[model samples]
Target: MKKLAAGNWKMNGLAAHLSEAEALAGAHAQPGCEVLICPPATLIARMAQTLGDAPIALGGQDCHSADSGAHTGDVSAVMLKDAGASYVILGHSERRTDHKETDAAVRVKTEAAWRSNLTAIVCIGETLAEREDGKTLDVVGTQMKGALPDGCTAENVVVAYEPVWAIGTGKVPTMEQIAEVHDFMRTELTARFGDAAAGIRLLYGGSVKPDNADEIFAVSNVDGALVGGASLKADDFGGIIGALERA
Candidate 1:
């Protein structure tokens, strides 16, 4: 499976910012690993246009559980696919926190995304308190049981671990900590999902900036990263992509 560096530009980007997507697609037309950017929903169509036939894929930050609905301001997975998105991020730490999303909600959304043929990047993580209590693995395992659907496959599912304490806080877990979580995730997924779990990508999401990307990518089971702020700029994200290529 190709390593994936997926960017979640949550609630950011406009028509003027579409140039960064173009710059990324131009610079890394065919990096060794896969490149993806989930720009704000408003920029999806134009960004996809900017990245025509490029290796850099496009994704969405979130999606509604329903295929179609009367919910105002809610974009469904069906809508995201229609808008040219190949993937949709579900249960991001920010969405889980700000929206108070439970694991059951994430699973329904993942099923919806898969129904639309969109790969689901399901996020699972521990809060600062859970980490402090040494329950990170336990928390993540429980989330996997709740968020993942019964018929999931590697082709349609990816898992991202973003410590609530680390995301956008300029903080990062040690390489050992990251390795532990990734390895545990691989084990947990394999236990329930069977052989296909070996192919499922496990991504780390936090303060994944250029300077630390190379080392993070080197960790065992660390297939790639789910980028945040660094992904908003072409240069920074390109730097991370370069590191993954080298890894």
Candidate 2:
């Protein structure tokens, strides 16, 4: 399976920000891995056009459950697809906390992503308190079981593990710690879904940056990353991609 290096520009970007996508397009992406940028909804179509044939896929930050509805402030998966997004992020910790989104809600959104033929990057994570209490696995397991939609294949779903405490906090788990969690996740996935799990991609998030990208990518079952702050700058994001290439 190819590694995925996705950038989530969460709640940021404007019309003029399309230049960032252009900058990313001009940069050399790591060979053997896929690069995707999930810009705010407004720039998806323009970014897709800017990155045409550049090996960089365009995506959406989030999507609504219903395809088309009276949901005044929501953007549906169908609309994202129509705007040229090939992927949609779901169940991000920020969204879950800020919007009080439940696992069932995430499942609905995941199904909506598939309905529009978009790959869903489903996020599962543990809060600081849960981790401190050694309930990380339990929390993650529950999220996965509840958020994942039925009939999702490895091709259509990518799992991202982002410890809530670490996101944008300049903190990261040790290599051993990350390996333990990822290995456990892989085992759980295999047990639940059988051989199909082997091909599924598992990505780590939360403070992943160019400096630590190589070591993190070297960890077992860590196929790639969902980068946050580091992804804002073309050079920093490109450096992480370079690390993945070397790894």
Q: lDDT of each structure?
A: 0.92, 0.89
107-137 in candidate 1: lDDT tens per residue? 9999999999999999999989999998998
Candidate 2: stretches off by over 4 Å: none
The residue-level lDDT of candidate 2 at 211 comes to 86
Candidate 2 global Cα RMSD: 1.2
For residues 70-171, could you state the per-residue lDDT of candidate 2 as single tens digits?
899899999999999899999999999999999999999999999999999999999999999999999988999999877766889999999999999999
Q: Which clashing pairs does model 1 show?
A: none
RMSD score of candidate 1 (Å): 0.7
